[model samples]
Target: MASLIDNNSNVCSMEEEIEAEAAVLKQIQNRLAEKMEVGKTAPPTEEEQKEIDARSIFIGNVEFGATVEELEDHFKGCGEIVRTTIPKDKLTKKQKNYAFIEFESSDSVENAMVMNGSTFRERQIVVTSKRTNKPGMGAQRGRGGIRGGIRGRRGGQQTVVVKYVYVNGAAPRGRGGFRGGRGRFNPY
Candidate 1:
């Protein structure tokens, strides 16, 4: 009879431990859900909004060796350049073939647009106004908005499918025998 009672006590304690663990798991899941909801609904701060509204232009197809001085010289006649930013690769520290040029005023944006399709370093460059999208605002067209509408499905879950094609494995002949392949040595 004593052994039976001991077995019952052990089973009851195990059930209680399982219940406690389940409650802890439920609490963690609730906290994660709350954090996600907050992140989705939070609005941009004042500084971020100002940055989004700043008069800037995105320059694509920039030459890998292009310098900020060259960009300033190209747009010097248009208007005062407030700032310039050229994103570089993390490992290579080379230009990512794009840059952002902020002008003193919105009017300068139009002036800078005249350089669209112009040649720089033997490559035709594209210049366009830079803009940001506010959350929950849907698609806002015209100058500053992103090109085309933001495409998404319900529940905010997206699945991306990618396909890669391999070309002939030959080292491209140019620019001091730089091997042109998808690796650390290749700058392109």
Candidate 2:
């Protein structure tokens, strides 16, 4: 009888918790539905992006714990620092071990490039001109991941990757030959 009572109490508590969770979820769903009715903010235009890229220098091999202030201080000698960006992982929200520092003048790019391979926080950081982002990120559309076969294309240079390319028509389909007997895979 006591075990029965305990089981009933546990079931009751679980039911109450589930009802509470469903109510909270419904409230969240309603809020999201209301918000989705509004227009989303647009991304930066191409010309604006080009200007930013021209002023920006990508800082690679940055320490995970490095702050924006420290990066600005380190690169301030090059020119007037406009903005410093250290991207964070979407899920973990931690620094991605790289940063971008944008100076007010494009000329500062050369000065910052001079600091390439210099030690910063015990790590040799690479400073380079920011490469323009490929529109589709190697994908046919802006849909998902990079499609196979297309290696890369940049600065009027084309790169292709091919594997197991057979000059003849079809590959030979045959059985294998075992070592015990002269069993070798024959491509006939």
Best by lDDT: 2
- Candidate 1 similarity to native, TM-score: 0.46
Worst 10 residues of 2 by lDDT: 142-151
Residue 44 lDDT, candidate 2, scale 0-100: 77
Q: How many residue pairs clash in model 2? A: 3
**Candidate 2 structure quality by residue, lDDT tens digits, 1-188:** 99999999999999999999999999999999889977776777998899889999999999999999999989889999999999999999998999999889999999999999999999999999997797765535421223322233334334434354444875434642211223456667
- Alpha-carbon runs more than 4 Å astray in model 2: 1-42, 138-188
Any residue pairs clashing in model 2, and if so which?
Answer: 177-183, 177-184, 178-183
Judge candidate 1 at residue 102 and give its lDDT: 86
**All predictions: root-mean-square deviation over Cα?**
16.3, 11.7
